[model samples]
Target chain A: MVLIYIDHSEKEIKKSSHEAISYGAAIAKQLGCSAEALLLGTVNDDLTALGKLGASKVHQLNNESLNNFDAKVHASLIATAATNLNAEVIVFAHNINGKAIAPAVAVKLDAGIVTGACSLPDLQNGFEVTKTVFSGKAFAHIKIETPKKVIAINQNSFGIQNFEASATVVEMTLPIPAASVKVTNVNKIIGEIPLTEANLVVSGGRGLKGPENWGILLDLAKALGAATACSRPVSDSDWRPHHEHVGQTGIQIAPNLYIAIGISGAIQHLAGVNRSKTIVVINKDPEAPFFKAADYGVVGDAFEVVPALTAAISKMKHNE
Target chain B: MNILVCISKTPDTTAKIAFTEGNTKFDENGVQWIINPYDEWYSLVRAIEIKEKDPTTNIHLITVGGPEAEPIIRKALALGGDEAIRVNSNSNDSYVIAQQIAAIAKQGSYDLIMTGKETIDYNSACIGSMLSAILDLPYVSLANHLEVNGNTASVQREIEGGEETNEVILPMIISCQKGMAEQRIPNMRGIMAARTKPLKVVEPLATNAHTSIKEFSLPPSKTGVKLIAPDQMDELVKLLKEEAKVI
Candidate 1:
C-alpha cells in the first residue's frame, strides 16, 4: 500500500498535505495498490475529504499527544504503523515538518529516502525517483533498492485533483515512545505566510532602503495575495524578521512565482530560491546579478516600479 | 548539564557550485566552506543559552568530515562551543554521518542532542532524525521555540501552515529552526576561550551508505526579463492574458 502522511497544525489541515495525497494516490494507482492516508494527532477537518484527493482509506492516529510534532516519537509511531499496515511506499510533503520528520522515519524503517521529490517515481526502472538537487539547480534521478521507500514531495510539484466519493476514515493506534528531549520554551514569528508552502512570494533586498520603506514590498505582496520575503541583508539589518529571509543562510523555498525587487541576486540568495519556477527581478542596477537569472526584469527603482505594478494589477482586476 | 550540538561543514552559500568530472563528485576546487547555518541555530545559540544559564554546563560541537573542515569547525568553536570533535571521514551520506553522530552521542550520553533543522548544502535535515531513530529516542524537528526543564523539553513548532506545541522527555534530538534562539556572535572572551578549548579528532565508524550522488549541475539560466513600458499598463495586462497565461 502507498501511505501518505497528512501534515497538519492544530486541527487545520495543511494545503501541502492535499498535494501529497494527490501524488500518493496517483502513484498508488500506478502501482496497482490502494493509497491510504496516515494522519497523526488531533485534526478538526473532515478526514473523509481526503477521498477527494484519492485516498481509499485514511488511517488517523488522533491522539492528543500525537498532536505536537515530536520527530523522534513521530518516526517511531510511523515506523510501527507502516510496518503494521505493510506499507511499501511512504510519502510526505517536503515542507518544514516533512523535511524534519522524513529523514528520521527513513532511518527508523531503514528505508531509502528521497527529499525534495519533484515528480512521481519511475517504477519502470527499479523504483527510480527524481528529486531536486542543489537547491533546485538541477535534478538527480535516484533508484532505491530497498524494499521500503520514503519520498517527500515538494509543494506544488503536483496538482491536486478532486474526485467523487468519500474515503473511509480508519482510526489506528501505535505505540508512542517517551520523548527524550524536552522543549524549554518557544518563540514564534507572529504573522506571516509559511514560506515553504507559499505559491507566490514578493522578496526585497538591500535596495529597499531602510525598514521604513518596506511598505512598498508589503503593498505589492498584498495586491498579489503573496507572501513577503527579504534578502539576508534586509533581515540582518532588521528591516524584516529573520524568518522572512530567503537565501542559502535563510529559508530555502521553491515557490511558483518569486518576484525579487531591489535585490542583487547573490549566489547565496539564489541557492535558497533557485528552485522557484518563475523569477521576476526589478532593480535599477542594470548589472545586478539577479537580472541574469530572472525570467522578467525591470530596470527601474523598486520604490517607483512596485507601486506602479500594484496599481496596474488592481486596475486590471477592476476592469475584469 | 552536558549538551551536544551537532554541526557540519558545507559549501558556502555564495560559492559558484559545480560538479566534478562525470558528475560523480562535487567540485570543491574553489568552493569556500562554512558552518551549516542550521547548526548555528540549534547548536551555537542553544549552547550559548545553556552556558549562560549554568556556566558549568559544557556545549561540545561535533561533525563528520575531513581535515579541511577543521577551520570551519574552529569557526563553530569560535561561535561558543567549549570544544569540538572532527570525525575523521568524508560524510559519504546521511546514514554514515548519523552513525558517526550516534556513536558520539552514545559515548557522551548527552542530556540533549541539538542541531539545525537542515543543512544548506545537502539540505537533508536528516541527521538529527536519524540519530534519534538510531538511539531510540524522541525528537522534535523545526522547533521555533524550545524550553528545556531538567530532563523534559517542550517545543513550539511551525508545521504545515500553523503552529503546534509538543512536550517530550530529554536525551532526545531536537533540530532547531527559526525563532529557536537569537543568533549570537562570539565576543572577545569567547573567541579567546575557544582558542584554548580542546578539539579532539576521531576516526569514523564503519558505515553502509544507501545513497550516492550521481552528478551535480546548475539549473539552466532563465530567459532575459521582458520589459513593458512604464505607461503600458493595459499592454501588460493584455500580455498577461495572451502571453503569460497567468491571468
Candidate 2:
C-alpha cells in the first residue's frame, strides 16, 4: 500500500493534498498496489470525495493534540500508521507541514526520503526521483536505496486527476502520545487567499517608495482576485506583514502567474518566485536583473503602469 | 545555557549554477562559498542574543563537512560562539549529515539545538527536524520569534498564511528564519578572538547514505523578454492571454 499523508488546515484538507493524492495514486498504479490516505486531527472535509481524487481508503486519526502542529508527535504517529498499513511507499505534500515531518518519519521507519520531489518514482533500474536543488537554479535526480521510501511532492508539480471511485473511511485508534509543545497563542491571517496556494499573485517592494503608495498594488490584486505579496525590505520596514514577504528567506510561492511591481529582481527574491509559470516584471530600470528572468517586462514607472493594467483587467473580466 | 547551532557552507547567493564531470557533480570552480545566510543571520545571531542577556550561556557551533568548511565555521565563530566542531567528512545527503550532528548533540547534551530552516544550496529544510527526531527531542520548524524563560522556550513559527506560538521545555530543537534575528558582522576584536577559538575536528561516524544524486541539470533560462511600453497596457494583456496564456 502507498500511504499518503493528507494535511489539513483549519479542519479542512489542504488543496495541495489533492496533488499528493494523485501523485501517490500514480506511483501505486505503477507498483500494482493500492493508494491509501492517512489524515491526522479532526477534519471537516468529506473523506469519500478523496476516492475521486485517488486514495482507495482514508485512514483518519483523531486526537486533540494532533490538531496543533507538532513535528515530533505527528512524525511518530505517521510512522506507526504507515507500519500498521504495511505501506511500501509514503507520500506527502511538500508544503510547510509536510517538509517538517516527512524526514522525521523516514528516520523512524528507516526509510530513504526525498523532499520537494517534482516527479514520481522511475523504477526502470532503481526507484529514482527528481528534485529541484540550489533553490530552482538546478535539478538533481536522486535514487532512494531503502526498501520503504518517503517522497514529498511539490504542490504545482503534479496535476490532480479524478477517478470514478468511492474511498472507504477507516477510523484508526493508535497510541497517541502526549504533545510536549504547548500552544501559547494562535495568530493567523484570516480570509485572505494564501500566497502559497494562490494561482495568481501581485507583489510589491521598496520601489513602491512608501507604504501609503501600496493602494496601487492592492487595487491590482483585488482586480485579479490574486493574493498580495511583498519583498523582504518592505516587510522588514513593517510596511507589510512578515508573512507577505516572498524571498529565499521568506514564503516560497509558485503561483501560476506572478506580477512583480517596483521590486528589483535580486537573486534571493528570484529564488522564491522563479518556479512561477509566468513572470511579469514592472520596473522602470531596464538594467534590473529581474527583467532577464521575466517573461514579460515593462520598463516604466510602476505608479503609472499598474493602475492602467488593473483597469484593463477589470474591464476585460466585466466584458467576459 | 548550552546552545548547539548547526551550520553549513553554501555557494554565495549570486554564484552561477553549473555542473561538470558528465553533469554528475556541481562545478565548484570560481564559486564563492559562504556560511548560509539563514544560519549566520538568524540562528547564530539569535544564539548570540541569548548569550548577551545571560553571560554564562555557552554557544557551540558544529558543521558536517570536510576541512574546506572550516573557514565558514570559523567565520560563524567570529560572529559569536564559544567553540566549534567539524565532522571530518563531506556529504550532501540530509540523513547522513543529521546523523553526524546528532552524534555531537548527544555527547554535548545541549539544552537548545538551533539550525536555519534550510540551506540555500540544497534547500532540504529537513535536517533540524530530522536531528530532533533522531535525538528524541521536541522540535519546532521555522521559528521567527523565540524567548527563553529558564527551562521553557516560547516560540512563534511561520505557517502557510500566519504564525502560531508554542512553548517547549529545554533540550529542544528549532529552525530559525527571517524574523528571528538581525544579521551581525564580526568586528576586529571578535575576528581576532575567533582566530584562537578552539575548533575540534572529529571523525564521522560510520553511516550509510540511503540516497545518492544520479544527475544534475540546470533549469532552462528565460529567453528574450518581451518588452512592452507602459502605455500599451492593452497590448500586454493581449500578449499575456494569447501568447503566454497566463490570463
Best by TM-score: 2
Tens-place lDDT per residue, model 2, B29-80, is 9999999989999999999999999999999999999899988988998998
Q: Which stretches of candidate 2 lie over 4 Å from their true place?
A: none
For residues A246-308, could you state the per-residue lDDT of candidate 2 as single tens digits? 988788888889999989899999999998989999998899989999999999999999999
A7-99 in candidate 1: lDDT tens per residue? 887578888999999999998998999999998888889888889999999998868877656666677788889989999999999877787
Per-model DockQ: 0.42, 0.78
Model 1 RMSD in angstroms: 3.0
| RMSD score of candidate 2 (Å) | 1.4
Residues B60-161 of candidate 1 have per-residue lDDT tens digits of 889888899888777778877888899999955788889898898888868788888777766766787788778877777777777778877677766543
Q: What is the lDDT of residue A144 in candidate 2?
A: 97
Instruction: For each candidate, give the interface RMSD after superposing the true interface residues on Cα.
Output: 3.1, 1.3
True contacts kept of 2: 0.81
Q: Which candidate is the best by lDDT?
A: 2
Evaluate candidate 2 and give its CAPRI docking class based on DockQ.
medium
